[model samples]
Target: MSDPHSTAPVPSPRRRVGRPAGRRAGDTTTRDRILDSARQHFARGSYSSTTIRAIAADADVNPALVIHYFGSKRDLFGATLRLPLHLRDQVSALIRTDPDDMGEHVVRLFLTAWRDQNVRTPLSAMIRSVFSDEGAADALGQFLATHLLGPLVAASRRDRPELRVSLAASHLAGLVIGRHILGVAPLARADIEQLVACVGPVIQHYLTGRLPAVPTE
Candidate 1:
């Protein structure tokens, strides 16, 4: 028999030099990989910041394929949230409105969605996840910033569009967290129509009115 050490030395796995060795050759799993990538990114950091290219890189697929399979980042987020809410259609209505009346539309649509049990359960889960899990928070935050507020900002002449988005989102998030999720006293018991009228004006103010100036030196 040849000597035990007769073979030449084997290379040490090439150290995988860069990018932590993302997935490869996803012929059957390309679509799944995109989702996997999206889930990973959404769950890992600021979900609002995750991009199509970033997800594609993670899944070892082309960015175009992400579009092919999911159409857009917002759609991908909907899939990730996996809620049955007619979220895409609801959100679509926001961009096609008169800017001055945008707040009422946003509030009305939000309350309308919460009216359905099928929609509320998953939405509750999404909000709960945002509260309890960093990754989930990232994902939801990203989804709201990109899907909900981004369009509003584009159509807004509001100073500090980013702040406008944050204000409006925070208002809605608080309403849901308190009224729906936590079942706060009067809010939980109030009529949806009442809440819409009450909150709609507030949201419009946030979206369009000038802020009171902070006292300064």
Candidate 2:
């Protein structure tokens, strides 16, 4: 006979079989789910126009979950856009040692990056958004400035004594927009080697060569 005050052995707390409670663990499936949703929304249009609620709905999760996993929309976009290759490191190395052939490197980088199915599909959408929407342009500009340009400048500090990195960067940016994004004639059709051959000198000039002097009185 058990005493009236005696209690039966308590069952151990059962661990959840599926996704953990509160916050899902930082597992691949959760990340993939978030990324899938992000791609859907970002590919549709601009990052600014894509709401967290919409992303959550598409992902089939709570809105708070996105924030919990990715921190912010900007972070989510970055994650989605991040290529497998270490672009900053690669570009930095190219700018430092091959400043003379920066244009070829730029073209190669763009072509390679776009070749990747994951990067290309989303990047195409980003390019479209940049042209069609103001908010997208601003967001993309900020992202590029912070991630791409900033790193390139820092990397070239040793080699670019004159510090004209901006000019070089601008030239590369123009080429990318014209060739890949806009699909301009001739440039779009040109083979990689032809483009590299044509554009390499222009980039070299921007990097280290002196500019033409203006007429003076």
Candidate 3:
């Protein structure tokens, strides 16, 4: 008979304790997977209910890894919803310098960003994604607080910061969509200077001027 040890079957190799091979838990691929999972969960009406554990499961990562990559669910959502630009820095600069010209500067800055195909393309996608994905609305609202409305709010030394933020946000959103997205008559075709002249004051008012009083019932 063959030797007992030689005839015996070899034991299977033990799997490693760490994350499986091929991709690291903290790699870009893993991060993108988390974001993609978040986007899917948001689009599927599960945003409010989704958890870090769920997202990690979907991404085949550990919950600790999710926390490692994004501190919390809201932060994960923010990461997923972030635009492709350094919005805070750019807007903050306009808000800081040239108080008198800040409004026009803001308009010009917007027009300039939108004029670039690279900027417009990603921005369009982000806008559409933000507005259409209602599941992510709360997260989007939080993000807008910092990304779009934060600058105007920061620039203002006004009474109601809420009013300033809301007013500026509404006006800018309308301006962008009306001009670039919908291509609405005069706004769509109007010259950049004309837009700056017309819309600048409105934004300026929202930023630094007095707001209309709320009527008591």
Candidate 4:
């Protein structure tokens, strides 16, 4: 017979507590993988050529997941632009590099920076804006002088440093604008190594070579 009449305590039913409501585990890692894949695509081709399906395939995730994390292709591009935060440091380190070969280093760096669409878009936009906006021109000039040319010029210890820097800057600016922004044929499709070989020496002469004296008024 059961001791129902006896005063005995019985255990209540145990309820299982599920995980807290939020992102699933490994979601962050998946998002990062998608971002990396997007950067690779942007680096290899222009933004117009890179597609969500391609990025998803590269990331090895479903296309929906990429959209779920980054929203749209533009949004993904905006995210990739943030990846070059260390570029300034790379440029700064040139000051400590060998001045003899600095031109090659500089040309290589320039090509690398403009090779990707994420960084190239803003740079091209700023350059185009300079035609109509004096403020943009001034800002661009100041940036080029301070960040790009100033450091290399100081390191070269060449005569007429200002003129040398200007010449070198002009050559490099023209090259990038024609090859990338304007998409000039032959030059646009030229191998990066071929460009480095042909253009690097000209930059070297402008920055570190002896030049004829110009009579000043």
Candidate 5:
């Protein structure tokens, strides 16, 4: 409503600043980029050695963004792989079984579960990773110790439960490696019931038997 020719200062448009490089407008593809980078890093490297900062640099995003999106390194490792679902439920079921028959059930569960392609593929990958990489071995051992074997051992209520868990887990891991991965002749061709019968008692002994005293160094 003022004079048409009056001199007036015009407002400048607000400038956007401090956006991370390679982060596109609206940040649409950032998550996908991070995941893609994670897959690549995990494929070639051990889980322990692969850092969030490394993955972020590879993805062209900030490390904080990786944490924001995926939570943690372990979470990122899980994201990069295809694993079986309802695993905790299966473990829970195992925990609910008869204590004496638990060894047989545990062996049977491993043998039967491996028959499923969905379960076998990921498990095989994880086991293979363990065999090949010390870092991965540590990570997987910690995960199994913390998540799966910890509860199972607690249920046994046995003396030196930690050692019992270790022995039982080591036996089962060897069974998977020899029978499934390495293709050990008789073990590879052995029937599930046969192996279960042979291995089950040994596992039970490890879990519930009187272990020898630890030797002093």
Candidate 6:
């Protein structure tokens, strides 16, 4: 070695510096902007109507960034449509109590949950998607059947409870769709107490009231 003690050429501190740090910060900002824009777009219309390019433009970011952050439109939609309540747990608790007035309790719980800001936007988006997209329709039906209906049916523990649970759930679902989703007339304008009074007995009938059985003859 000509000079073992000689120091190796010092690496330039400049080599360690450039746009990487700035680029990373910019990326994070861009991702947040994209998500905010996406939520706004989805809230105003169905998922089918909100395009990725439009969201990217609204966010003031490149289209690629939207895909990079949220993967696809479906994935983004799902992310945006999350509920405020722990639906399974809440419904399970309500049904487990075996209340005599289950319908009133259920309706109250539903209305209260829907009134939350976080819940309302997602629910509105889901409702719009269900009407406009076949995939969304299937997803929403499956979600309702599994989470909403399935739990109540399992917890009913009464005779021929499947039919009862399904009927009750259908009635409640229709009420919500008409009033909240479709914004139907009197139903939409009706106060919460009025709705509960009008709808509770129908659900109660489905849940517990006796019906004529088919004749064996």
Best by TM-score: 2
Against the true structure, candidate 4 reaches a TM-score of: 0.57
Model 1: how far residue 215 lies from native, Å: 7.2
Q: For residues 1-217, what per-residue lDDT tens digits would candidate 1 score against the true structure? A: 6688778786777664444333344554666667667767765554446788899887766687788778887677666655344776667767777888888888777777776754555456567667655655555566567767767766776677777888888888889899987989999988877888899989998888787776799
Off by over 4 Å in 3: 1-68, 71-77, 80-87, 115-122, 129-132, 136-140
Order of the predicted models by lDDT, top scorer first:
5, 4, 1, 6, 3, 2
Candidate 3 residue lDDT tens string, 99-190? 66777877777777676654554345445555656645555456556765665667666678877767776677778888876779888889
Candidate topping lDDT: 5
| Candidate 4 lDDT for residue 59 | 80
RMSD of each: 9.5, 5.0, 5.9, 10.4, 5.7, 6.3
- Tens-place lDDT per residue, model 5, 116-165, is 76556545655767866775665556655665666777988989998987
Candidates in order have lDDT scores of 0.71, 0.68, 0.69, 0.73, 0.75, 0.70
Model 4: residues >4 Å from true position, as ranges? 1-83, 116-118
Tens digit per residue, CA lDDT, model 4, 1-217:
9887987878889866642222453578778888888767766665556789898887877787777887887667656544265667788888888888888887887788876665676556555545665644554555556667777888778889888878887788788878976799978999888899889998888878888899899
Instruction: Please give each candidate's TM-score.
Output: 0.59, 0.70, 0.62, 0.57, 0.66, 0.62
1-217: candidate 6 lDDT, tens digit per residue: 4787888896767665422222243467766576678789878887778898888877776677677777887766665554545754677787676556877777776776678776677667767777669766654555455555556655666677667766776676678789887889998888998888888777767766675695797
Q: Give the Å error, residue 179, model 3.
A: 2.4
User: Number of clashing pairs, model 4?
Assistant: 0
Comparison by TM-score, 3 against 4, better one: 3
Segments in model 2 whose C-alpha atoms lie over 4 Å from true places: 1-28, 86-89, 92-96, 158-170, 207-217
Candidate 4 lDDT (Cα, whole model)? Answer: 0.73
lDDT (tens digit, per residue) of candidate 2 on 1-217: 7688878887999886743323356766877887898998888877568888888877777778888888987778767776555776676676566555665676577566667778776666766777667655555555544555445545545454334456655566677678878889987888878877877777656655676665699
The candidate with the higher TM-score, 1 or 4, is 1
Worst 10 residues of 2 by lDDT: 156-165
